[model samples]
Target chain A: MTKTRRPNRAEVEPIRVATVMDVPGVIALDEEVTGLLKPAYWRDMFERYGARPGGSRVFLVAESDGRIDGFIIGEVRAWEFGSSPSGWVFAVQVRSRLRVQGLGSRLFEAVCESFRAAGVDRIRTMVAPDNTEIHSFFRSQGMMAGPFIELEMRLD
Target chain B: MRLQKATEIALYAVLELAIDPERQLTAVEIAERYGISTHHLAKVLRDLGRGGLVDSVRGVGGGYRFAGDAKRLTLMDVISLFEDVSADTDELPPQEAGQEIARGLRFVLTELDTQSVATLRSITISTMLKLIVRRPWATIALEPRRPTVRRGR
Candidate 1:
């Protein structure tokens, strides 16, 4: 009997900067996780972050067999609350069944590398109090409570 | 972890005054509305006063008014005054199942505690007031009105 070995993640999956053609795959992966179809939001994000001229904004994706298994988006923002310039990651998603294999972490690191290249010293992201999964992921990545406090008010 | 009664009362009193900074609410009025003890509420109010979170008004229509900045003062600021929000997992003893299980449980508990403290620190008094107003059943309005329970002084 002949044994067939499965390919390792690094060999099968490659992390790279997202292109315009990767938008649909990114949208599908996000929809699978959130259970909401938001093609327009993903396209808009691609235009604003992925297609921007400057390298300050980053949009990275992890691909396996030509499928986007994960994605992360972040940008450099400064002086919002008297703080210095820092990288702010606003979105990240990995396919549910394919999680726990470090794909999300790889995408996260790729974005961090982009931020580091952009001359930022710190990184920040906001997570809902109830989202323990994402919170745990960021915590594992050495993120903790930041100085800024988020407040909101309703107009209606 | 459950908040102490004093912490709950302090939150109510602070929110009452913070929602309308110009409005003043006596400890008795706040206690009556919440159906809690006036004496206990008075003590809590005194602590809040000492913390510089509220000011005691004198003369007619005198009561307690919020003194702290609503935008900057977070719920954790008020909660820390009455409760110990720190995660003390190190105090846990080893379980019969062994140190491994105990350590695992401690880690989970510590994570929960950290997240709770983070959530409290993120929400400001102003944000809480907005959330309250947005509730569908919160038709009672922001104005302080006399509750149905009438307690004699």
Candidate 2:
């Protein structure tokens, strides 16, 4: 019987801070997943999170074989609605075909390390109810319900 | 997450009508497509008509047409008409045993309810339509398929 060798994850895909050159890859990956092209939105995100020098905001991407497979964006928010400073992950995405291969988990851990370095003890994020994939991923990472409620009303 | 039969039917009817705002479909046609009861769908459609979400036509070949703005109409709006989406807490008479576990469970359930409501509120009919179109099977399921006729050998 022949045995298949398992590839080293770190050697196969490396997670690193995103640069200006990586903005296009991030945008393309996002569009591939969401089917929407919002170059301006992504450019603005890169400008605020990647280009800026603040350690509070972090934008990281996973690269494999010179292709961007995933990206995560988060920042440390303080005293928003009377809560203590915490890391808020606004967006995270991995290529659909490459999901469940631990890329998302690795990206999540990389961002969490950045958050810890920024001196935040807790992390927060909002996921849609129908987005079970993300919910399960967060749950696997030991995230549970937090002491907060989101309320909204429509205005014409 | 549970919805009343009326609410579910209303959602199907509304989405069907909204698929093409110009296309009018009778309650019977909508019910038939979904394999649901026409009588029940009629009641739901009547309520939707009162809600100003649909227009009922009176004469030959006339039916209900979507009147509400698909971009503005949300699943929560339609659901609120037939049922309350709020999470209601069960009052357990003061008991020492399992109190902590009960409190924790309640908190989790409340959080889930909050997330559900927010998700429903954020998703509009237009968004739902886009999602439906994006699904690989949706196109095949939604489009009318022509019947194949077998030729004599």
Give lDDT per model, in order: 0.82, 0.84
Docking quality (DockQ) for each candidate: 0.04, 0.04
Candidate whose lDDT is highest: 2
TM-score of each: 0.50, 0.50
**Per-structure clash totals for the candidates:** 0, 0
i-RMS for every candidate (Å) is 11.4, 10.6
Candidate 2 lDDT tens digits, B96-115: 79988988888889888977
Model 1 TM = 0.50
Candidate 1 Cα outliers beyond 4 Å, as residue runs = A1-12, B1-153
Clashing pairs in 1: none
